[model samples]
Target: MMRITVSFLPSELLPKPLGAVAPDGQDSGVLPATAIVIDVLRATSVVSAALANGAKRILTFADLEEARSHAMGLRDQQEAVLLCGERNCQPILGFDLGNSPAEYDRETVQGKTLCLTTTNGTKALQAAQPFEKILTASFTNAAAVVAALPHSNQPIHIICAGTDGSITGEDTLLAGRIVDACCKSFGAKIDNDSAEIARRYWLQDEQGQSLAERLRQSQGGRNLDRLGFGADIQRCAASDTINVVPQVTARSPMEIAMMR
Candidate 1:
């Protein structure tokens, strides 16, 4: 019996093999299920774009120092290593790129190894490493994320990478979209109220505005806008724009790479 659990950030109420959707993390008592981390505002969206555009691999880190250490390694091994990340909705002091989907393209990201750290996205990825399998997702690659889900008997968990400590609407919307798809394609059961709310949202439309508009109104979206990242909000909102689902191929030094 495959069950689907959805939760924003991390908590203590639910833990273990039953499945979990968490944005933050738990070292101990964390679930042993497959974890899908969604950062629709920018992080995972940019990951999808980077992979789709031809980036060989993406190394995600919750801490800047660890990411920098890995970046130095990449620089030694490869001629061009792209250091991309954001802190408080702004690019790091010295990075090749910020957390923006539009910035990743065939010309810039192609054949480069990306070392990325983000305020929310990378944190979720690190925390989810204890799961059986880890996946990165966003509305930009929702279809690919769904397609990558295996039909195993194990439960499925969708984690929404919220802004700071709060649950952001954009990530929850993507989680809902994924949950709705899982229910349809895998016949997976939604086992919680949060998942139910997301599923209901996935079934409804935006009325007049787009999914992007809704994100722009969110606190996460407003932060990006205030940081002069209005362009990124639009790019990240477009659904199915990219077709790559980045699955965590390596956990220890965290590598989210597309299966080529």
Candidate 2:
């Protein structure tokens, strides 16, 4: 039987060994567990929307410097690569766009490539690379992420890209959404503090609360809004807005595949 668990904020803030758990004595820390990397404020949501909107590919970097270098390297590759992401909610200088799902519309990313770098989201993706599988999740595509998994017996780690490495209500809410979906599929759950807390948050936020309203109250979401990107908040919070789940398949140069 497979076991499912949820790991929320500050988990990514620490360092590597981000967050791992085992179910039924299957210690996932010592083994490769599937990781669902989430950054609900923007990153993962933008990535999912971009891929769904026909963007050639999304290249993720831990910081702007690396993303810039990658962009330069791909200069000769045509299709006009665009540098996109944010730091503390402010758009990265010289980048074509910020980490907003709405910015990835068909008109802008129709046939272009995107080089992404973010304060928290990209870092979470890097921290979970050691996992057997890494998939990006957000409210926009929560159900799709769960369906993208391999249906394996291995434990699943739902890792959130929290605000400044600290768990925010928003990511945990998204994590809980993932947890609920996972429980529905596997019939088991993580009985830990982190998982239970996330479940509670998800239930509260899901109870007729507007997606933007829930996000605006979250730490990351608030900070991003304070930085003049409040509109992005509504974009990220829209449930089921997209159907693609971006899975990290390579690291050296960042490659994501649209699953399910």
Best by lDDT: 1
- The TM-scores of all predictions, comma-separated, are 0.89, 0.88
Q: Candidate 1, which segments miss by more than 4 Å at Cα?
A: 11-32
- Candidate 1, run of 10 with poorest lDDT: 11-20
Superposed model 2: Cα runs more than 4 Å off: 10-30, 205-207
- Number of backbone clashes in candidate 2: 1
Give a tens-digit lDDT track for model 2, residues 40-120.
888888888998898877888886798998898898665488899887777877889987788889989977878888888
Residue 231 miss distance in model 2 (angstroms): 1.8
Best by TM-score: 1
Model 2, C-alpha of 173: deviation from truth (Å) = 0.3
State how far residue 10 of model 1 sits from its true place (Å): 3.2
Q: Per model, how many backbone clashes are there? A: 1, 1
What's model 1's overall lDDT? 0.81
